[model samples]
Target: MSNKKKERKLAKKLLHKYRLVILNEDTFEERFAIKLTRLNVFVLTSISAILLIILTTLLIAFTPLREYIPGYASTSLKRKANELNTKTDSLQKAMLMNERYLASIKSVLTGEVKTEDFNRDSILKAARQDIDFSQVLPNRQDSLLREKVDKEDKYNLFEDNNTANFVLFPPVNGAISEAYNLEEKHYAVDIVVPVDTPVKATADGTVIFAEWTMETGYVMIIEHSQELISVYKHNASLTKTQGDLVKAGEVIAMAGNSGQFSTGPHLHFELWSKGYPVNPTNFIDFE
Candidate 1:
């Protein structure tokens, strides 16, 4: 019974009303008045606080004003960062490709490439499959001319030219002082010429090496198309340098007895095809 009485007392206090008034101080006249219960005031205050918290959360989550907060990245900054990442990737790929290209060039220059004998007959046979052989008949003169051409081309190495628009130019007009002898390990032909004779490029190519060596003296190496490389040694001086572009018959060096192995003024010319040394007389007439 005592507990019930205490509970009733507490409820009465919670529901008790209070009068609030606004007054004219001098006249003591009531201008405004309101009656509010304790429970009503508490409920209204709690509701207002919750509403204010929800509004603050919404502003921060949905508006750009959230950028003012710490540890938040701006939208523009994120976009720029992504763009820079893409550019970096592209630059890396380009750099890798350039490196590979340079490696291939270096291998060719250093004679480190593997040798492969290209089968011209097989390639020509495959290419001839598309040709129409019954286009026309040849006259008696044409047959004679064809026979003459066939005889002339029988021993010519480059007669069935594989590379398009490719032709070799003789480096110099001189007699062969020392012919290429594979049995004696002599891989180059010694062309006997007067000192300071101009050595011309054999084909359109880029100069990859132009320098002096103890055994070969001043040497110039040119890289031509169709896996052909020409080397000129025992030079008095070089007219072209590395990385230079030269056309066929362009003067590249001067012939002289400049090396330790040279016996007289001459040009030591070497031809390499697909990393293997080839006889220059096969493709060029040095009579």
Candidate 2:
């Protein structure tokens, strides 16, 4: 037979009708009946399978249940994991540095090392190291990259190119107990939040400083751009460190009465433009 004829024959066989009937078991009478075909059944099953697959895919891709799947993690989850790992590594380094400092203190207390009349020549010789004075020539690719970076950095907050339109996140949710007073040398505003309240970043930036000082206590400062900097002072503890990038509204510290100047728990938030302090209340509304 010809190919066309063969296909027609097979199609006819598939289209063959079948009877699906429910017979009364006691009386042998047909209680119900429906007409069905092989082709019809096959098509129905295929469509049902396709619908099931579509629903399953949508559920996994669009819902939080996707996290339950092995080897699958959302973009935000991955980023958080990386941030935590970086924090862990930084803490390890800090611990090692602290250990070295403690060891030096112990040595001084025990007289294991001489405090004075040390050998200046030995110190100078130990400090001496070989220097690589080879000049590095800039390639075409490097020059192009440098130019691109410089061009992008030119329109920063310092130049007032775009920051005036940017909205800032409130560092804390509280009442402003103290306003910015430049005449009184009070450059920052004091927000009165309950103790242990989180202090958040006002913009996306890298932490430039996170340390304890006698005046500020546990202070954290973030550098947003060439001209913009946000400082959170009198914190109980800092969650970020120098060089760590933080997003707007991300918690960077906890509010507390840490410094000698602080009488109660609060967040002393300061915004700096260029070398001068700006009124944070102008951009952020604590109330």
Task: Using TM-score, give the best candidate's number.
Answer: 1
Cα lDDT tens digits for candidate 2, 15-104: 888999999999999999999999899999999999999999999999999999999868999899999999999999999998986575
Model 1 spans > 4 angstroms off:
1-165
Measured by TM-score, how close is model 2 to the native structure?
0.45
- Residue 285 CA displacement from its true place in model 1, Å: 1.2
In lDDT terms, how accurate is model 1? 0.84
Query: Where is model 2 more than 4 Å wrong at Cα?
Result: 1-159
Among all candidates shown, the one with the greatest lDDT: 1
Worst 10 residues of 1 by lDDT: 106-115
Find the 10 residues in a row with the least total lDDT in model 2.
Answer: 106-115
Candidate lDDT values, in order:
0.84, 0.80
Report how far off residue 131 is in candidate 2 (Å). 59
